[model samples]
Target: MSKRLYVGNLNFSTTHETLQTVFGEFGTVITCTMPTDRETGLPRGFAFVDYATSKEAEAAICSLDGKIIDGRPLRVIEHQERAGRDHFGPGGGGGGGRGGRDRF
Candidate 1:
């Protein structure tokens, strides 16, 4: 099965092509994505890279974790899927608030 990795602490200027080139050295990259802020349309300083196999993914994690790219150390790890979390619907994660009340 394919493996997905979470790549964090990325430079704002990092691109998908750059990730493909760098990560491809270890193994075949099936897919790469760099998310952006919805409002500002700026790079979110993180990305997800999918490898064709878990072995390739582990190789990348061993070699590239903490490797500096664009002056920032990358945080590479196996991506874990959250269970039973519907983020697209209401009450997804809007918990823990004062509910318009103040502690005076």
Candidate 2:
């Protein structure tokens, strides 16, 4: 099964390509995502990397965790799913607005 790993304590200048190149040493990197702030559009100093297999993910965690890159040590670990949350974020769907209530 594919595995996702969370990479934290990253430098602000880290790029998606840089992550792939670094993590690719262990195995195939399925995807790399670096989240940027909505307003400033700057790197959040963290990233998520998905490997083609669990073994590949493990290899990366073992080798890259605490490894220094760009003057900062990396924190690599298996990604955990947040309870009661999805890609769109928390809460159970329908929100905002007056729920069809006539505001007169």
What stretches of model 2 exceed 4 Å from their correct place? 85-104
Residue-level lDDT of model 2, residues 1-104, one tens digit each, is 89999999999988888998999999999899999999999999999999999999999999999999999999999999868647687666776787465776
Error of 2 at 89 (Å): 14
lDDT of all the models against the reference? Answer: 0.94, 0.94
Each prediction's TM-score against the native? 0.81, 0.80
What global local distance difference test value does model 1 have? 0.94
For model 1, what is the alpha-carbon lDDT of residue 38? Answer: 100
Q: Give me the runs in candidate 1 sitting further than 4 Å from their true place.
A: 86-104
Task: Kindly list the per-residue Cα lDDT of model 1 for residues 1-104, writing each as its tens digit.
Answer: 99999999999998888999999998999999999999999999999999999999999999999999999999999999877666686565765767465766
